[model samples]
Target: MSVLDQDLKTPIRLRSLTWLRAPWLFWGGLLILTWAVSHYAFDIYRALDARWIIRFPATWQPDFESRITAFMDWLLHDAQLFGILFRDVTRAISAVIEAPYDLVVDVLVTGLQQGIGQQAVQILPPLSWVAVIFTVTAVGHYTKSWSMAVLMGLCFTYLAVFGQWESAMLTLASVLIAVPIAAGGGLLLGVLAFRVRWVDRAMRPILDLMQTVPVFAYLVPILFMFGFGPVSALVATIIYAMPPMIRVTIVALRGVPEELAELGRMVGCTRRQQMWKVLVPSAKPMLMVGVNQVIMLTLNMVIIASMIGAGGLGYDVLTALRRLDIGGGVEAGLAIVVLAIALDRLSQAYAGRTVTQKAAQSQGGFAMRHRWSLSIIAVILVTGLIGAAASWLQTYPDALVINTGQIWENAIGYINVNYFDTLDAAKTFLLTWFLLPVRQFFVGIPWPWGLMAMTLIGLRVGGWKLSLLVFVLTGLIVLSGLWDKAMMTVYLCGASVVIASAIGIPLGLLAASNPVSNRIVGAFIDTLQTLPSFVYLIPVVMLFRVGDFSAMIAIVAYALAPAVRYAAHGIRSIDPQIIEAGIVSGCTRGQLMRRIKLPMILPELLLGLNQTIMLALSMLVITALVGTRDLGQEVYIALTRANTGQGIVAGLSVAFIAIIADRLLEAAAKRMRKQMGMA
Candidate 1:
């Protein structure tokens, strides 16, 4: 049948318009309309009033502060109980396992300490900062090319000149340690999960939850288990950073050619041997990508972990934020950005080089000769030693150190003189007029109303099963007495998602129209993604102050990437033939884009919206740093107080929200695709 004939037989209907006409819309709209009517039209705002009342136990006086005190007392009692249990368990486990491992750990620690101590004794003085920069440049050149080398040299130069050497080194040390540990754990987990169906089934939801839950929720549990130190920070970073590696590893392993698996079997290879020689080797690229992700996540978390006393560049950033020091935060944030870029590039180079070297080896050329590679390594070593020896005459200084006090004073002074008044004014308006009113509406709804609304929406979109799941998840929040906090979170997330879609979609459309713009915007998105969210929050706090506005801005910045990415993907994926036909049929550029291109990309755009929502939810915990009173805030408070139960509950609430949104959007996307005959 001809295309025009097919169209006549089967008419195209836009889902958005159909959705507007659906009965569910009327039901939802009527409920909202009625609520609006009662509240605004009739001046009956009783249902919109805050219902929560602060109450104190009999042991405390009946006052607001007394209630807070009583709650803290209860919290302390619970913490004490947890501490005792934890200590007893640890001691018991230590008695069982430490006898063997204590000696091993001691021996290793002592040996390493002695070796490092002896090496320190004989070490040459620190090289000139110039020489170090040169060395980095040379290393970069060796890895990639002169442009990268020069860029790396300049980056290191900035660090040294800015006197952030020690802080940067400390941050680097943590990441260097954390990445390997996370990647190793991820590799093992990924392999196990892929090899065992039961493991995969058990782990998939966990991975999803881990990825979805805001990072703040894990902080308290980690702090409790490891205690407050670099070790705790390290553990938290690893946990937060490891999931993507595990996911990618599983995906890559599964994607390996079936013929390769069969070939390994035909060679009589054991399962372990097949995994090691065939499966793993073939999946190296994906595994490397995972490694890259782990590295990025670790670097990103370094600053965040610092807030809980991780101590590093992150500490500096956090301090700067607390003091509302913009320049200092920017300086520290820049260092982090440079570090992220360097590490990212190095990993990419390593991965790309691995592929190239493997191809060279397969070709069996002079370039593949071990002797040449070994000689190059020998020369590098000799050169390093010579430089080390020559540096002995010089006095070594400590790594770069920033005068944070000066930066703080200057930045705070500048903001106080110029920006603080404006920020205060804006904060008053937002709080008094917008945020407070919106928050009141969300928290005012009886728990049942919110539950019914979300459940009914889920049911209509996904089905009865998803509806039940949604009720169970959200219902748990209401029952746990976290309904208000969850609602506040929903409000913030909802606002951020709306703003992100508004900005991201338009940018994506513009970028999709041209190649140069696409590359430019694509690079910006990449930078935004890799740049730690915390770093973005620093400048935001400086500009907007520590309020919902700042938090929303940061959330929108990070969350918008997926929207742009998916929107671009959707527009690009539209068939060229259809676009040409639109043009040939006398449609203007705007008409072609509006009618044909936009509709064609609706499914992909919907998918992007799904991703944008997910990303926004993920930022809930991180955005707490900007001083939100949402579930993220509760999670943060739980961490500081070691309230694991509250933290977990809040985290799960966020996760549930994501899942509900995810399922509904996915179903809608699927339906749209099917309706478009593109399923």
Candidate 2:
């Protein structure tokens, strides 16, 4: 195995000894070499570009763009038989889903999405904003969360001050409607999947597909069928948000011990009774986690929903971005973040409340005991009296409104004067010294060899089925002629994930090791996590200018929060007894972490990596706006043009990359679990 060995006498030995130790490195180099030869030495681009990537003429496989568009057109226009059946089915679904749409609009505003729902169903027109504010205050008091109440008030006040009350109300109403539906549907489906073996088998892949596909993909068909409005956005939001709920549900329910379910049966409980009284309650904590996730995801879609004319803060941000008004977009984006933070805190606090809270309500003071009832009655009378006294009391006065766009612009000017030069130099160094080389390595890979190398990776990680998937998807990208862009995305996302993991894992370890540190860092991570992806763009654009490097930084910034969060959770969740064992064995803190903590926490860390991948890909799409020439750019362009075919293909490529990473990680985790006797 040394230099003395004949097999070790070559460059292969050097690669085997160093770079190839990481699979990513090994395949990357081989693919780059293949492409270098193909492009520079042989000039294959002529033939490839001639067929316009239609049929790899070299192989005979069809291009994805042309074929997918043809398929979509056939399904929609040519397949009258199938089209009629689908049309009828969607018509029924559209009719059924509209009920909730009407209800949501009615509860939020009077004339919204007018004519969609019955006039008799509209309810909130009679209620003043003051009434709604007071109700939120009452709930806040009940939850013992003055901070949450203040956040909510600030959020609403900001919306009012900005004269965005109507838009803000629409956004909240959509979320209010979407969360329950997403959470409820997810819970039901999750329960059924958990209870039925076949259902679980069927659901796993479908959920994977649903979650991995970009949220924008949902708009294409739904917008076509339902036209535009709240219902379309609501449906897309539900679909986009539900996967996490379903996943958490399955994981939580299964986490409940078999002995507990057996105890329910031992008490002579029937199947339904046992499921209701024992299983569901046992899984409440995880179900609540799912609910928290559902809320965040639904909010995440606020801007994407705006793309289809679903108005609100997202629309405001989109409008600002469209006008190239960075200050205005940042303002709107801030409002969305505040809205997200308020919603996230409210949902978390309510979800985390214990039986003791209810017990206190029964046994404690009048404020606790009466909670919402007395507060509601009083607030109603006070608001009614105020409305009677002056009409201006119903909503914040226009005369008192503040314009913060100028403030944001002034702040940008200050930053540019003070820090822009330093930031530009650093960005230049990062691009010239680091990212360009890595990006070139990835983007230079020849299609055929890249496909084979990825297939090999699939074979090593999973099996033939995975290899086939890798082969097919990679081939699709090459054929679609979006190969360079897709690889650029791969390079950026991969680099960002690696950097994020490096930073996050150590930070997580620090937090995990100390209770106080955990709380402090957890708060910071929570704040970062709640900021909308849109908000991540503004500062980086200010610092680095519009480019791939800036996009990478933004992707990492948005992605890093989840990495640290899950890593800390994984490390902290390690069994205390195992740590005690390590201590009894005379291990130091460092040794205990290496020998005991890491091994036990590896599975959770892999799950974190999976999450990190998804977050990075999601951000990449947003970064495309900042001038990253990746699949996100294609998707972004597709958005502007409403190019369904190009968007779908590009989105699927991003999805396939994420799914492949997920599958590999999952495969590795399964192997680790088996080795550790966890499976």
Candidate 3:
């Protein structure tokens, strides 16, 4: 067809599309046209002649902050439920949570004491560092391989030698106590959800909210209800960590084969027995996966929970950051990384063991089977007997302990001094040329125009209900007087996500294309993911000082793994037959990737983007530590002031932004899958 014919057909197409005739097409077109004009052509405030549309006027903004704070105060100090004082109820709950936590802390961290004040004698020193290290190594050896044993031994030794043992132990104690509770609770809930349709339906959104909401958002409420202490931190960590375990539990249990359940029924097993014995055992491998997730998440929360008084390695890092002691922060951060790697590796090793391997190990005599346990007991006994004389056995001696803090500080100082101009130039160039302009553009857009654009996009992607949801959520941000801060968050998180994707996609492609590259990239990505998000701030802050640039670098480092992992998995998962057909059709490698592979993997890339966005938003909150003036900073400020309302509102605003992005991207991915007939 000539250009004239094509142009003539356009009028007929337009004529056929109207509200009464083709509402979806007509509305979609109208929305796109409206968005294009409002976003690109029409200056919103100038055209409307209303400054209130540009920035929500303070007088008009709702007093949600005060209202929320007041409600929290009443709930904490005066409210009653079912004729019971809420404060008393919280106290009772706190006691229950505190009991096990205290016991674990005493056993693993704080030494038992006899008497009081100066007369007090240390009846026991918190498991001798030597014993702890030996036990960790022994557990590693018993569960997996000598390599794992060596890894654990080295990790624990690093803590002891580097003067981080006590703090690391405190962190570990919390993790050890939290993991079983969170994982078990998650398992029970998941089982219930699997058994009951309504329970599953009800839990889906709650689980989504629990996982989507930033960890800092809940800290204020937890502190208010539970009182500020490690117990509050414990509660916060549980909430932050349990969602993944529950999600994994549901997925794992659902993935169990039906044949095993049928076999149990045929053998005269009751429903309870069938579920407990047949279904659960069959899902053990996957259940362990959930447990692993619980471990990792618990470690992540340890850092954030420190702000509320769960003092440990997290508190050390926080203190160091607060004082601007780069060396000290890096040392503490590295300790966290070491602890995380050890836990992650141990859990993974245990999870990877086969039923046959376990059964084989179980057949040994009692003494042989329990050799590692016996060795740990022997070491502890020996240390207790000799520790009074050889005090170093009880605690790592201060004189011998390594001080890498100075070394790290000196290294960072050297770099900053030697490369100041070059680093400053690059940072300035990026901020001035790209970041500032983008931020200004986003901040300058009228609130109404931005909201409408989102609503229209939501409608196009997921229809009217989603559009309404987006409108209300975004409108709430505006009314809460957080639109500008929210936009700043968008600017920061969006920039980080874009940079992460650019770096990750190529790496993912390389990993997907070659076995060696896959192994190398997979290992690197795994290590990156295991480190707590807080740790990322250390090196970046050291290099760039405190600013948005540092925060962006941290966010990118923390979020890059998902994008790479998802991209690699997506490409590697493509049907071999399809690739073969492309090859037979004379497509070059580049041509095949461009025309076939990339298109096929586009949905996966979108899903990866969704994950990247979620991670960046979560990291965005932590980035507040380095002085980013976004919603994260608002939450941080609220936390410091103990302003429950401000923190919750700011947190909800961040979560709303995340949810909006999540829903839009997910809807787009779903649509793509349908279009490709892959759904």
Candidate 4:
């Protein structure tokens, strides 16, 4: 056998001699010595009050932000392609997008109009709430089951009764237009990437950066380029949400069986025919997963997109939150969650709809095959005629609409007044004992020392190429003069991730071991994952007030799902034959688990850790609104000021941190997999 083949067959634990050649011991000693020296220097700097030793000197930092801003200015105004100004190009693109966007909006919310202002007449009314609810319910029943239809029906009914129908419909209109464009664009790019090897290689890093960069980071540029309105918001939502579908499409297409590809070729099919007719159809099951992800992510962007004038339920929530109208904010937030759940369920059901089921349902006749579609059409016409007579059918009656805002306010007030001391005491205890100290330690470390430590870890995990990548990316943060803020981000994200992992791993273990726990935990995490990151902040901000403590709480809640999910998946994915082998070897349950399962699943746990870190970083950005001073805050401030340069820098700093953490953890997992002979 070749050397690589033989090495792959032999597990690292059985190769004792290999350790003799490794420099890990020397590196470990040097790492400890470097850490001690850095701490000694920190003490000296503290005594002498030399702040520059701990923090990079601002005067020496590069002026990247100004240069970036200048370039953007040129691109927006001065720069031109051929004979056309860039602004004109952008405007032309906007016109194209706006055509369909206006169509959806008019059909759903505004109603079709003719002539100008005073002379304008409504050609048609927007879809009535009754018609909308019926269509959604029928779609659910056709796609999945009676339970799904009922769920969708009740959700829309609640929206109408709660007086949020108009806002909800506006949001739905944006989603309806954005999803097809984003999904189609992503599908095309994914197909291109799959067919061309170099394209796949090129897109990998871009996709990583796109996903890791917080949504807020790119908003300023999009707003600047597209101009602030629903168009800009739609554009931002598309950009933010499109990456996942691309990733999912690439993965799904790559996973298609080679035999299937060969079968197409053997039948004398052209490459295009093979791809579109055979490969895509075979990958449809997985592609549907991508569609579901796209839908959920589009909804998640609603509130964030609203910041740029994409008005809807998101605007309502934002206005309420800014005024500290906690009750109103919670109501709107719940509306978002309800909308998310309804859309998520419908998309998932449609995706899960199989050929057999579809065919079986369609077998009766033309009318029978499309009974739901006909019913939906019938409802719309009936509702439109009735709405003309009794306007309440067109618009829910104001007096009959429910208002739970006062009740929610009263409950929050009761808790605040009665449990003020207890909550404050708990918050103080955590900040004083654990959080503050960790923050101070991270902040006190000299920048070079921190950089060196990370570089060394990268070297150990993945070698010199990884080490250099980590150094350069992190070093740019220092060069950009955002080192302190980056450290603060690291501190907050790291602490939250640690806490989440501690809680999640044990729960995941419990769920994996017990059937009832599995069902309960599985369902809970599924719901939690579907809710937008903003919804988590409302409840947290209410209870904790606003500070690092509150940010940490929100981050933990938003990030906890991934840790739990990955851990359970890892535990459940173990080979049954391995368990049988352990039993046959006369090992007890605990022995079998510790020696075999835990070691075997270590890579998966590492992956879970990686996901936890990524989520914590993303949530940290949203937490900036609550007054945490970190990289997220920098991005947020830049966004508010429309400073593209500053936002991009800070955003990149956050992305770099995430990329470093992700790569290091992935490297560790790879090493573990190699050692376990599973690579």
Candidate 5:
């Protein structure tokens, strides 16, 4: 037999064959060839043949400027009239009712501003950095460990030293307030959905849409309703952050052991009592995971909310990006990362401890002496007292106050003068030679033909239902008068996903093969996933300018995490027995991978594809800032002009697209899993 075949037949000696040709080599080579052809060969040919592509009549650019100006004019006029009428109505009503509650609200507002606000402002000077660090470390240690404690201490110290203490605290305060509200709301909704099948059915689509819809899409309607400020930011954050919690809670609750449910029933428990005493406790781990996810997502939204005047680290990051202040951006980004890690670890530890306690309790008490409940309680009480005392003394001051707006304005001014002029020259070259030509090819395809091709592919992969779903989804986009825009979005997102998969798959393979590489890549994935999506945009825009290419590049960077993670997982999950079988059959390394591994991992690879698509779409609204004409642009305009109806409609359209894609992909994944006997 050949050396490759002989090596594959030897089980124990396979470790030495790390350098042997694997199936990936062939696939990877094919991909490289295809990329070269697509990126260079086709590009060159397309450039040469560009004049031959049929050009459709250009649609009039919507009279956005005039329309927006007129809308604003009318809105201000209406607001003036409404303000006068509201004042007159309130006066008439107040004169008639003269209620004590109205007086109470007025007094409370005045008191809050005068007493609490003044005290907070005055006391801001005495709180020492050492004390703050100590407090954070103590809390972290109490919740988790010495490692976490040290990390937390360092994080706080960095925040204080870097002069972002006040803004950080404000952001923290908002999170502290918003997290509970979101968690409680999510828990309630989740419980309701679990109890009622119809509620679950009703909520499923809404939750899916909420999770997938671009962040900017919600800003328009929310801003219109609430107006722009921290309150509006809070509302948007809550909406965006709550959905994952609700889904997680529902999933966890449903996963409660049936035996436990029966035991609860046998104990003469009412349904409510059983739920509170048994179901919720049983689902604590999952619920906590949900809480952890909620906090992370909420924190993620904080910076984005700053764009609408939420005023926190998000604003700092936004300002930094606008001004190309890499140092400031990195600092703010690091703060966010530290916060995310601390919270994630603490929550995970809490969940694990709870599970351990439950297991220990099942085995009876004395053995569970490791329980540190009292210590935890003591720490909480001590921390609470310290916080209360500090509040009372009004001695805690803000750490840093850096106005980045001027920095941004000056930077933007410079860009307008020099950078854009350079960018415009590049833009002309790219648009004329590259983007326009490719876009024409995509858009020029007959819609019916495109629909048919996609539907058939869906049918082959996922069966008839998915096929119909894909068809309807594409059909709806066409009907919405956004067919071209949707196609462009699809092309950009698709290209990014493909490129991400190309890079990620190999990295995943490499990581899977090496323990050190695996750990490093995994950690990197965590960091990348936690970094706010906008951070990627700044660098991407800097490199590529504000256009489709930059947006696509950003999407690729952001979407790569899941592809790498899932692909690594899939490779690692390959059964040892299967590898043994390949060995016994004297399959070469390449043959083993081709005949066994790739086929076995197809389901998982598709799952990665699904995630890649989802993540790419999530950037829809964010990409608008880079100047791609898509649904995100519509959403942005709606927010800017305070048009709730338009925002909601546009948001729903994006949601529909996500849902359609999700359903189709999920169905395909399910089918593949079943076919592979992995379901």
Candidate 6:
């Protein structure tokens, strides 16, 4: 038998240098040589002025942005082929999308922002805390699980009692607009991609770009096109949330049985009929999952959307962040989590509610059969009566609303007082010892040398096409004059990924050792991923006080979820037959893990690395707000100034970094698969 197939009770032992294959020697030598040349050759690595660097002309710097803007204007207007038609097209789309958005905003916003009610002298009243609570309870009961219903009620009640009702309502209203548009648009697009080979191929790159592009980056083009406020936020959220659904839809449609499709064909079904009756019905389970994803992603964008004026809970969090109001900020952040958890569980329940024909026939209770219609009617009646009878029911009274702000304030205050010196010393040490060397290593590398090394790595892994793509993107970042900022961003993300992986892998392995631990770890990961991104900065600011260290800690928290999850999944997914073989051979626990489990799960582990890196990079823009001088910082600066060119260039730089890392890891994963004979 091949050594790879053999199961031995003893652990596999290797002689020194025996495992160092030719590919490793070649790639390792190339990277080292490139690093030497980049760092030591003719002092070309300096940022202020450097050899082997191509700088954009100084002459074009002054009006470059205006020139680009002018060109675009001309292309959209002076270039007459698409002038009036383009305008009409955008106008028609705007009319269709904005009408419902306006109605939702009117019903929820403290005043009508824009709608038929805009000219109405009376301000549109917002939903009262009591009414909203009643509505939430009704929806919870509609889920047909009293436990889930109670959890939903408690979560939203925390929001109302903690004095976040108005903001939560505003956030919920915007999400209402966003989820439907995003979900509907995603479903349509998914169908198109599934049905058309050309569309499926074309959409892959676009989806990659959309998914990897930083959330902070999303605001600029959206702000430029739609202008700031809820409309712009709504549009951006839809774009951000659409990709996953489209992907899920394509997968689900393709998952339908070939035999079933053939049956439809034999029955003389038309294309539309076959899709509507056969394919879509079969795909409903996965489509519902995609819908659940859309809702979660829509909620996830709350804090980000608020950056451009989609107010509510997000606005409250942002406001608190700016003012450094720990208590208030914490409350607002928790409110967002509450909203996310409620939405998530409800959606999950709806998705999981599959009943067999026999099961359906045996089902009891009128509510189970007609939950939606009945729930809506009950909610409307209860809310209407309460809202009409009591002024307080129109809006929760401030006296009745409890302020838990003082609690968090005191907690943070005590920590700051007790641990300030210790934290400062620790932060200083990390800055000096840990973060700086890593930052310098990346930032001080000459552009071409690192680029060449990456190109070589890409060639070794994914072949010529991927290598060329990496070259083009790396070249663009250098030409954009953001190379230094890009390097710092890379450094920050790299350090975070390493640290997160170091912590997460062990946790994952431990969790995988038992089912109870796995469940506990899974719950934690879900909670971590669902929390508002802004909330991560809160405790970091309190402790580390906002720099690379604080940013690193926050990035670690945000990115660790995927890493740990991937590790646990990989460990858990090991073939049981392999385990049985190891056990029958009398392999020790350590031998079984080291020889069988870890080696077998290597491909999955690489995939987890890819996701962890992506998550870390996503935090770049947000981390910059806490004062890290990276590409994210530049994006933040551009956002504040509304500098379209700078913001876009920086955003693209971050995306390029993510894409490069993704390509490298994905290629490595494919290589692992090939080794396992699973390719």
Per-model TM-score versus the true fold: 0.78, 0.84, 0.93, 0.93, 0.74, 0.89
What's the lDDT of the predicted structure labeled candidate 5? 0.70
lDDT tens per residue, model 2, 1-679: 6656855566774545554346777667766666564445224556455432222453553556667667766665556564365556656776777787666655555533333435444322434577767777667667656776776677676777776676677788888888998999999999999899999999997888788777766676556656677677777888899999999998999999999999999999999999889999988877988998999999888888887768888888777766667788887887777778777777778777789876877987887677578878887777767765676766668897777888887888888899878878887887887788777667656666577778877776666687787787777777666777878888899888988899888888888878999999888787778777777787677666788888888888888886798788988677789889889999998899888888888987898888899999888888877888888888878767766677788888788887888888888788678878889
Pairs with backbone N, CA or C atoms under 3 Å apart (clashes), candidate 4: none
Residue 114 C-alpha lDDT in model 4: 99
- Give the range where candidate 3 is weakest over 10 consecutive residues by summed lDDT: 13-22
**Residue 373 lDDT in model 3?**
87
Which residue pairs come into collision in candidate 6?
Answer: none
**Model 1, range 1-679, lDDT digits (tens) per residue?**
9987875666455433345447667577957853553244223334444333211123332233334335544553443454475445534543543343323322212211233433634323233445445656766765666787878877876776676755676687677678887899999999999999999999998998888887887786666555577766777888899999999999999999999999999999999999999999999878999999999989989987896667668998888778777777777887888888888887776666655644654565565545435544554455446655554212124443445556655766687688787877977886688666666566555565677777877766666787898888877666566766777888888878887999998889988989999999989898898777777787676567677888888889989998999888888888889989998999998899889988888878888898898888877688887788888888788777777766777787888888878878888789788889998
lDDT computed for candidate 6: 0.80
Cα deviation of 175 in candidate 2 (Å)?
0.7
lDDT of 6 by residue, 1-679 (tens): 7665554433554333233346878677876785566466445435436544534344533544566556545544445444464445545666777788767666655634433444656444555565566667776765556787788879878877778877887888878888888888888888888889999999998999899888888887667656677777888888888888999999999999999999999999999989888898889889988988888888778888888878888888888888888888898888888899988888877777657633763477887776656766666566656776776766667788888889998998898899889878877887899888787677777666767777777777787798899998897777777777888888899999999999998889989999899889888888898887889998778777778898999999999987788888898787899899999999999999899998988888889889999989888689888999988988788788877767777787899999999998998899889989978
TM-score of decoy 1 = 0.78
By TM-score, how accurate is candidate 3? 0.93
Off by over 4 Å in 2: 1-55, 58-85, 110-126, 144-164, 266-268, 360-371, 381-385, 463-469, 479-481, 573-605, 673-679
Q: Residue 528 lDDT in model 5?
A: 83
> Model-by-model lDDT, in order?
0.74, 0.77, 0.87, 0.88, 0.70, 0.80
Question: In candidate 5, what are the lDDT values of residues 1-679, reduced to their tens digit?
Answer: 8999986788875555343234465446544543444345345547777422222223522433345445544553454464574335434533432333223222212112234543643222333345546766776665667887888787776666566665676677667767887899999999999999999999987888889878877776556545567766777888999998899999999899999999999999998999999999999989999999888888889888887768767888888878777557766766777767767777777777754544644574653443445444454455445745565322234444333534644665667577776767776775677666666555555444456656655565565677787788776655555555666766667667877899888778768878999999988888888888887876566556677888877887888988898888988999999999899999998898788987888778888888888888887678888898877777778777766655665666677677776777777678778878889
lDDT, candidate 4, 10-107, per-residue tens: 98765643542366775677656665755587676879898777778889898999999999999999997898999998899889889998898888
Model 4, position 202: C-alpha lDDT score: 97
What digit string (tens of lDDT, one per residue) describes model 3 on residues 155-272?
A: 9999999999999999998998789889989999999998999999999878877887788988988887887899999889888888888888788878888887779999999989
Q: Where's the lowest-lDDT run of ten residues in candidate 6?
A: 12-21
Q: After superposition, how far is residue 103 of candidate 3 from its true place, in Å?
A: 2.0
TM-score of 5: 0.74
